[model samples]
Target: MLSTVSPRVADPNVRTALVETAARLLAEQEGLTIRRLAHEVGTSTMAVYTHFGSMEDLRRAVRLEGFARLAAHLDAVERSRDPVADLSALGWAYCFNALANPNLYRVMFLEAPIDAEEAESGGATFAPVVAAVQRCIDAGRFTSCDAWSLAVQTWTMVHGMVGVVLAGVFGPDEMLGHLSTMTVSLYVGNGDSRAAAVRSLARARRRMEPHAPIKRSDGAAEFERPRIQNAAP
Candidate 1:
């Protein structure tokens, strides 16, 4: 008797589910096996092979998805009159994506060795940051520095800060504030634009945050909103 193949085997929805589940499992338990993933996804091990040629391929897909989502998040950030604010928005969006998908984030940034495909994915993810830096340079907020160098430096800084947060050394509340401030200061200070940097940071923070308080139907502020709860180290 021929076994019926699930039409979803190669569907994008199933592929996404498998990739997302794989990332979460890999993040929760480093060194996740294909067999385990199949068991968790409630499909035959063949499903893994069908969707992704192998576990390494699955991991690659997971990493690629992470970068894809990051690119979209950064893309949605409105490019406004404030170049510094625009750049800062990209910076924090990086962190927001990390917190939302720590397991996938780790896999994308740290878990595995990078192959040619992974390199391409990584480059695509950082292109927005480079563009944002260029905007700052054009606005005279970053002096004569090349956009690539500044982009790489700022990314390295944010990457290191996120690593520290993921390593349990720094809580998000404590470290994110310090890291973000330092990044803005470093960029603006390098251009002799300290005062402008201060204003940029203030404006960026205001723009990212909700000015009006979140109120319940009775009008009391929803003080219970736990901002930054995941501490997956």
Candidate 2:
């Protein structure tokens, strides 16, 4: 009787190693081939399919991982007592993160699709910016504007600056930091004194009111009470 050889199942460690190798390749080349990647990883195209479903899927995973790292950078910025300062820090973090991870950064903001469904389902990869924008609004640093719109605006400004830097429109060290600062300044609108006073008053009122129960709105609990809180006398 002839002996039969059994096929090996893909190990998680091996799969992760392959993915990491692919991510590195994508980062370096920006346009990498699966055949080349498979050869580098000593795996078959079938293995890549089995592990990541498709090349698109793998790219999405890589981009998502990059966004997670970027979010962590933003999170590390100190929570400033001044909302404007905090907002500035958030914007700075966005630009810095992109500069730090040029490959992953390009994938996250520039290479991704602009479809509505993709935007809605992009998961944690996209949530950090929205959450950060909401935080600024909640802190009364930004006027009462839709968080989604503000998030897009902030993203546009930061991403535009990063793009200019990456495209060699300017030297990497020359105008990058200056452009980032200017972008943040434009977004914050020269520190409106009247707006800041209004925000302070609103915050004071919110803190004095008792916590109200959330009500069901279209199957979701809505916290109707204003978010800003006043200090105790």
Model 1, span 17-66: residue lDDT tens: 78888887777665578888778777778778888987778888999999
**lDDT for each residue of candidate 2 in 209-231, tens digit (9 for 90 to 100):** 22222335543223244222222
Q: List per-candidate RMSD values in Å.
A: 6.3, 13.5
The lDDT of each candidate is 0.74, 0.58
Alpha carbon deviation, residue 113, candidate 1 (Å): 1.5
Candidate 1: 10-residue stretch with minimal lDDT? 224-233
lDDT of 2 at 58: 80
Best candidate (score: TM-score): 1
> How much is 218 displaced in model 2, in angstroms?
55
Q: Give each model a TM-score.
A: 0.82, 0.59
